[model samples]
Target: MSLMCDARDIEVNVTWPGGPGTNQRLEKVPSRFAFAFENEDVKGMEEDCWGFGVPPGARSYGWFKLLLDKARKTEYDVEDVAGELTNGLLELPTDMTAKEVVTAYLTKIYNHCMEMLEQRYTANILITTPIDFWLTVPATWQAGAVDDTKAAAGSAGFGTRDGDTLNVITEPEASGIAILTEQAERNPELIKAGDNAMICDLGGGTQDMQILTIKAVKPQVQLEEAVPGQAGKCGSTFIDQQFYQWMEETFGEAFTNLPKTKIGHGSKFMKDWEGVKAAFTGAAPNKQYYVPLPALGQALGATGDHGVASTAYDFMDNAVVLSGEDVERFFEPVVEKAFDLVDQQVSSLRRRKQGSTKLQIICLCGGLGESIYVWKRFNDFCKDRFKGAVKLFTDKQAWSAVVRGAAIRGLNGNTVLSRKAKRAYGIGVHRPFREGIDQEEDSYHCPVGGKRAVGAVAWFIVV
Candidate 1:
């Protein structure tokens, strides 16, 4: 099937806890919001799908526990001592109940997905819902950071970096739950027990590598409960941030001085920053703005400024080119490490003396993995180094693979995790190492003294 479509087809991004709902919706291929509201379409058939991470500070402790425990007996008495001691953690406004927050969170994720899906590509939705619940726990949740003990002890407790900040950290793991559940339900037979598979989830913000062990007869995938730091923050947002910073640095005074209008009561900040950036990046030579160019020029201290002129071309060229380059450089380290991971897995298999010498298939799925530059590098590396052992699976459907997988899992929850596989690989830093953007290899080392060592064994599960 032709996966490429016009970008306008995708209208909105819909996010839910990963599961059959999302998977079914993805398969339906929603290109408009009308599909979501017109029919009682629980699954967003006419919309493009994508997932997002709740700000590290907003995920629910109760939901977090439920996810870690796979919805087991994880609830605690709200009246207990620990609960009373941490009542402040549960003090969100009455209108912002946990459920409301979750729904809104999903909605925001959906909107983000839709915006990205519609930009520079054709699709109904871009799905971030992954089969793996990728999360990162702070290396140490000390007293000042959060009450790790209370959180672990089943209290609805929260922690923070500063005194007033609430640190209900939600890593990528929380985002994947919505998509995985959707996939597990659709393909019970193909995904049956004893099947060992690795999920390569490329999200907008991070890439998650998960190992799933299928049960002997079940359809569920066994997941590790612990957090791992293997994932990197190579999200596309880095590009946006770079662009924003560039704009700020180049035209902060002029841009900020533009008349500001609060929309929907301050929920949305509407200014012409985007217009200015667009006019600069677009092929058009000149674009007019509501705010006169002379005023902006005066603010920018430009010598002969007239009405909105064509200078945006130069501004965009300089800023966009730099941002693109930075995007590539930002991902280089992670790309290098990704190959290193594949090598480690391959080496492990070779040691086992398995009869199958054929290389394991390495699939690429996620926002970061879809980058042309990253994909080219990975494909070239695999082809040159491992011969045919590496396979970079890129289909039109690949971007939404995680959500589809998640949805499939959810529908098949009854049969999920019925299979098992041996988990032997450890995804952790082999040594403490840090290096500047262009530093030499010898410059990489631990900040603290002595030889760098593996910090911790990131979580993995057996099939």
Candidate 2:
């Protein structure tokens, strides 16, 4: 499932043999949840008043998963979480803690999936057949955050039924499986065993890059990591942030002075920006794009410079007209960060192979991965650097690659044979203290033998 602000952010795809032909069904649900109150009496509201809609005065808590991840290093408190929430485009409710908000959001998604399943195949099927859940998490997520996700899923009733199970895999791995499987089926000649291919999973909030070597093509596909994965917070959401920043700079007080309650998250201005963002391809260098300014419609009159001169943009027809160069300014930085990640992985693979091996394929998958401008930039980079030695791969299903891969993994099984550690991990051990070598602060007396010892770290795996 995707947690972006897009309309088709959360998707549910079922693969069962008991249903109709192909036995596969897919549904896209808005990644939106709201809690509406009637006369300040929130406690008396039914469950129907919440979950999956844009009702009037309802609050949408986007990116709550980030808070769950943050809870790993810091304590989980309402005040801290509330502060983080308020710092964003949305505000948190005073009565609910961050955990409660996440639980509610997940539970709502779960219930909606279950209702769809019951409608597709009668409720009897749900009761009789065992159900297994496979979830995809960002590769950059910490182990503690993954555990938090599992706990939240359990609280949402997953793995609660008899014979039910839940499994979690990194989002890049899932996308790799789906893309490799599709490539193997459609064009087997494009890739073969022992060839290294880099997978770039660019989603809404994070970008993960990994290199994998094909192990076997026959008797089911198998894969092994060529190098450890790398990830960063440079995703499509950053582009949106850049867009908002541009609005503030270009429009001045006419944009910032707007009422926060009416022009904050989920506003019409953002909705229009989404359209403009998706349509931009950097294909026409001389063409211009326009985004409607519904919130600033009246403010445009007050500014008095609506049609006035500007090097990058102009205000006309109650909209902002941006040149192609202006649009590229919003996307170039984020895309370049992603390119840096890809370069790091490629450099690692080159070092491992002693500069003898060449990267055969570069797979791009996820929401931002579908950007035509992004694809063009990568294509040009590969041509100039690799001299056409690398083949770029992407598809129309790039946004749903993670969920589709999860469904494929649930139906079949894991295709990965081995993986490399992203970083070094070790255990702390007590060693006999050496007067000259050990630090005084690290020395401690052993309880078993009453001997002086020093704390030391034993590394088992190194990146």
Candidate 3:
């Protein structure tokens, strides 16, 4: 799921990794595909390919994340984008085709995987091997986004050879499947055939929730969406923004006037501050968090750490200190919104099922989903609201759960029987109006056919 490479130049001869040979089949296990790209060769051309992967340089890719944050946005011309990867509505800095970029990312991952495969089995055998790729997508992504992704994958030559196929699923659903699958393996009775669960996937940049219904547990456990998934831009990444702004506001000009270099101390502080956040557990943190700002002295023209010579301003010997309360300022805004989304999901299920215990488990997975603070919050909310009737759980494989769960889907394509529609879908058409059957006021005259029809209404299935 995450590609952490230090940017090493790849070896010419492909070799397998230290693990098992690719030819060996391990039943009920997920495949490992990524090779650590060490920092020496870590920064690469593809790193700048639109912001999905790590950025080559440091200014935050605000626009990229902002674009994905929306469930519906300016639609891209699918054919145009597909035909020419670089051609699209949004401005792109690089001339790399979207497919070229996607393919490059895929190739980087698959090349390592192939090397690992070649280690156990011969490269000749691995060359013709058929592999399934399961990619994760946000539940709220529009069809256009998915279309673009598939087009990119196809351009990347994925699922092209014999027996090769691409598989896609909602991120939250995949995480849920991984957790539920493991639970069933440990305890056969973890979930019955008709049990239901809610999966809250809180990643670094997005929060997604899905309701799953267990279908069967015989040959292998199968599941499907019981209701539409919900998602938003609220994720752990926002906390970094919160912490950053808090520093600027607290220290006034000193923090605000820091150097704007991508590798500056300010940026390094943010990179390190993530650890501080992961350690947060709903507890009042330090009165003043201290950070050694090496970039500060240089930025203000201060020869030494003691003072800024140009402005004759004084400063700490080696660090800038900030209040813990200021660092936490941004957390509640994002957290509360996420809590509300979860509440909506719970309400929908209990309201829909009404009579019986429909939701038995609330599984949290993803980057933020692994947070002790969030896990506790959801657990406490579930216990207080559901009175311990609903269970709260997360997995040790939370970070990679989405990708692994996706692999499970690829292996068992039929695991999900059906998915709930996110919204009503229908087509506009003219129909004969009846006094009792139709609402007279709602009827409209069809200009083409000269027939009566309903205006601005979905005539098909309504969830």
Candidate 4:
């Protein structure tokens, strides 16, 4: 059966099976939400609500999932949440918590998808066919974050209709399903039973890796985890963060003191940077990239130095010139961390196999995985390390791999045989107290049998 799902990073990608004349449909919404309150007492007014890929103003919130993950273990406090908001280009109503902002953002995404579907087909299709939602989350997420995600999805109206369902899977697993399924269909011989492959999903917010061994290829593709997944905050967004830091450092107060309206989410300068970032490949070391800063120019006027003389940067024609070398520097540290994660996973796979087999393939997919430069770096590293023993592959539709895979998994059912747990799961219990082993504070009296015991844990699953 066809299904609807979304893969969320710095943006949310929604995909679903198409109607009679189409194959599939995809929509991308920035993980940004904005609300205009009529007054201090009102919030999320429908007329004042909107979402965009690059939000129109500074009041919108982006990268909120990361914020939620950070605050997962802490108690929710409005003031504390406000402090976290200050770190980013986020502005929220003082009364709203981070979770509330997330819920509103998700709800906006859901409504947008439904509106598209209704326009394509009749609205009656929504009522006749139950839409199952399959969401992808980062492997590094904690239990609290997962639960919160589910709650937000539900609150956003997913799985609320009759016969509808909601399912959540780690991002790496979802990408793996899509990449492996496509590979098996196109070149079955490239992967075989007993072969191992590493799937790296490099999105805007995080890089997640998983190693899986092909269990079977015929009839249907099957896979089992060769090792638990690994992830880090080494994603494309970190590149943006580094670039912003460089801007501040190179320009000094000229950049740092700019008004939010000039440099906020949808400003011309930010929009130009987005294009520059997307096209950067570090292929031309001597080339210079210019990002126009008309607003900054007007603010500083003709006499201002624009801080170019003191640094390696140049300001000409109201544009800031960045060298290819400087842009590559912004990407190196983040890319290195992703490479390290792959190294760790490969090392574990080698130890597990004990030389019986080697990593036969490396699958890269996600928004950042679409980078030519990233692919080149990975290709070079894999060639040197594997010595022509491994094949590096990337999907043509890397940006939507996770969402597409979620749709495929929903239609074909799960092909994974088993998965390794990242952490242990257990229940707390009371065991009969040992005379000297049990601490005095841990001992408890059992009323039913009048027995002394100490609190302990029974682990059902181990990582």
Candidate 5:
């Protein structure tokens, strides 16, 4: 920070509370309080309290499912909370809004950075210094949602630095920017100018895609969007939904209906499933795996051992036996959606066939994108479409790619240019309608120009 006193190029490493992937965790440094929250547990998260020494009236908490149970008991609007997490904001209480949670998290980070940087410089330098923040959001998020995130970040004290500005970039584009910059650092020739690539960022909450065309090499890694980015709620969590359904089928309605907190044993099932999903290569006809179920005690309660309980489910040996064939079904929906999105993005560019729209590279990143199954599916798609010409890249740091990329972009490096607009743009105008030239009924006087113009669209832009 001292060297890059102009926050534009400043770099600081930090961690998010209970992130979706392992890369989000900052190890090596004492975490002040090691904590994480994931899966459905995030639905009930109300707040986070972390800092140095005994902060006034602090409540130390861990990733516990009981938050959901508590949320249901109170007037905590869960539907609104879930909406806030996925979308942008909801008309909920200040403490319960996702915006508040995110800002608070960022505030903690800001405070930590100040504490660390202030040690080397006096308050005069620290107070006068300018620091800019760049936040990354999912490509699927609407403009309003991006604005909401920017507003939240500003509230978190990040807006106080420098020009009181906060920049927002799509997660996929940011990762692409980081990769492009790194490629240049290694060897400029590795990624030649005009090279076209697609960034597939499949994270826990959303799947974001961005197609870019390299514009320059010598000056810096500049990029232009060959096609508009596309994204949706197609992430690993979708697979979890399928597994939850399997639980309902394998166990019983009682298990499915039970509150998240009461189902402590389900955690074991989730962990085991993650292992199975990770190691699974392909469909093996006879291969089978056992995912243990919660014990059902003899007392016959929801929390009891399986067979003996009336409400709890019973397994042959306290496990749900799943075959490789059955496991494939659970992932098909999510994997298929990802395939479709990629195909759609690539197809759009191919149809246009303008300005080196060739997608030579397909880079996958994020927690779900790292899956062997996901890689194979995309690789197969690319092989058939490009006839083995497209290269697939998924490095080890993919989980942290977005953050790293956003950091690089914060340094004020231009990595994208001429992004294809997500939506079509056209202007409404007035023109005289002639006989047989336009439909008689389609003619109408222009409100502003007062001229009879056909109610026809010009379709000025192809995309």
Candidate 6:
């Protein structure tokens, strides 16, 4: 097998062109490395790296296409979408919002990153030499690319409800890439850590569980995608699904019956999908949600009848109460399977133990890692089963931790240096009418250009 290696594994901080609230940044330090040569496979490894709701992976792209039904909506003018909500992450996009357009455009790149991450280590084996590979590019770059590729792509208007919202901005994703690349260059020693550790990147959209087992000569993060591990398979989207179904059942046609309710809103399932998706990643298969029905009804407005035309608050009281039992019923098997996978890995590790090498830290980064239920259950299982020998890193920064690590990694790529440490960055954009459009954009920027680097590259990824 030919080995594809770059002397410097660049780091980067990815972000949006305009800036925060509408873009994303690495919330944590990241890791990057060159793909090495295995028997017949080209392999390199990274840990704790993740591309959430809109990951840059083929599966993600495929998933987006399946959800959008793009073939049926030829009139969709993507450039017309725009937004201006603060805590933009909290704001849902209307069809007019830029979220949908940006997401569709970004999905292609997200899939590209996923492909790169998957193949960087494994693809080279199929080839014969250390060839240069292109990681995914961010949206601003895509802006030009889309204009050249899409038939409807054109000068678009921007607004929140109607007009321009975010001020001048740079692609946050690109900014993240630049920072991460620089960080990686500054601190190559951190890459050496890959030899011993594995990454657990649990996020709002998906639980990206990767295993980086260090071999003496070869050190890289291996995706345990094929093999299940102790990590839960579900994600925040799971909870959202439950909430949606429950609302649909209780409210009946009322859920979407209001005059203001647009049929297209239902298509934006990805918003609440995060709830269910996050639930699946927890140590326990079960999760609970106490959504105030009235609040939902209010959001739905005239769409819901409230059974008796009663006050919205009254309707809220009648709403269903989700429980662990309900969650377990749907997620138990998946959770158990996750544990089983982890057990297998542990067993494998035990067999490989030669003498007395100490185990490394298993860091958990991502929104799901912050799940109280998940952490409690996972903690209980680890202590009881592993006898507390295994260490799981659960910090408050857990949700945005991977981006933090990615940023530090990006910083390492640059010439600036102080001491060794870890940290993160980014903004979130929400699309109301599209599938899987709630994307996080990197917000870090190069002071010089006031824009993010062209593509989002990073030195190290924790998940």
Q: State how far residue 55 of model 1 sits from its true place (Å).
A: 17
C-alpha TM-scores of all predictions: 0.39, 0.79, 0.69, 0.81, 0.67, 0.39
Give me the runs in candidate 6 sitting further than 4 Å from their true place. Answer: 1-104, 107-196, 213-233, 246-289, 295-320, 323-334, 347-360, 413-463
| Backbone clashes counted, model 6 | 144
Off by over 4 Å in 5: 1-128, 162-164, 184-190, 257-259, 262-272, 275-279, 285-293, 296-319, 423-463
| lDDT on C-alpha atoms for all candidate structures | 0.36, 0.69, 0.59, 0.71, 0.60, 0.35
How many residue pairs clash per model? Answer: 65, 0, 14, 0, 11, 144
Among all candidates shown, the one with the greatest TM-score: 4
Candidate 3 per-residue C-alpha lDDT over 308-403 given as tens digits, one digit per residue, 9 for 90 to 100: 332222245545554556555656766776777777777777666533346887888887777887787787778887899887888765766776
Which segments of model 2 are wrong by more than 4 Å? Answer: 1-52, 55-58, 71-99, 260-263, 283-285, 307-316, 353-357, 423-463
Best lDDT among the predictions, by candidate number: 4
Higher-TM-score candidate of 5 and 6: 5
lDDT at 21, model 2? 35
| RMSD (CA, angstroms), candidate 2 | 7.8
| Models ranked on TM-score | 4, 2, 3, 5, 6, 1
Clashing pairs in 2: none
Question: Which lDDT tens digits does candidate 6 get at residues 131-200?
Answer: 2222221111223333322221112211111222212111222222232232234543443332333345
Quote model 4's TM-score: 0.81
Clashes of 2: 0
lDDT string for model 1 (1-463, tens) is 5432222232323433332244433322211111122223333334322222111112122222122222222111111122211222323334444333333333443344445546736453323222122113321122222333223322211221123112232222222322232234443343433333344555433444543333343223343322121343333333334443443454554544443221100111212322332223212223333322333444444634323323432343221122333334434445665665555445544554423333434456555555566567777887898685554544344455444443333333322322223344567654443444323443335557544444546666632
Worst 10 residues of 3 by lDDT: 76-85
Which residue runs does candidate 3 get wrong by more than 4 Å? 1-122, 187-190, 217-219, 260-267, 285-289, 297-317, 322-324, 353-357, 423-463
| Candidate 6 lowest-lDDT run of ten | 77-86
User: Residue by residue across 1-463, what tens digits does model 2's lDDT show?
Assistant: 5321221233446432122235434223334445654224333334333322443334455556666666232111111211211333233457765566667777876776788789888899978878888877877677767888888888988887899998898888888887887788777898899888888998766788888888887655678888888777667767777777777676777777886444454456665676788788884767877776655656766666555324334444666778788788888778888778878888888788432356889999988888888898899988987899999989678888888777777766767888877666688888877888778788777787565665678886532
Please rank every candidate by lDDT, starting with the best: 4, 2, 5, 3, 1, 6
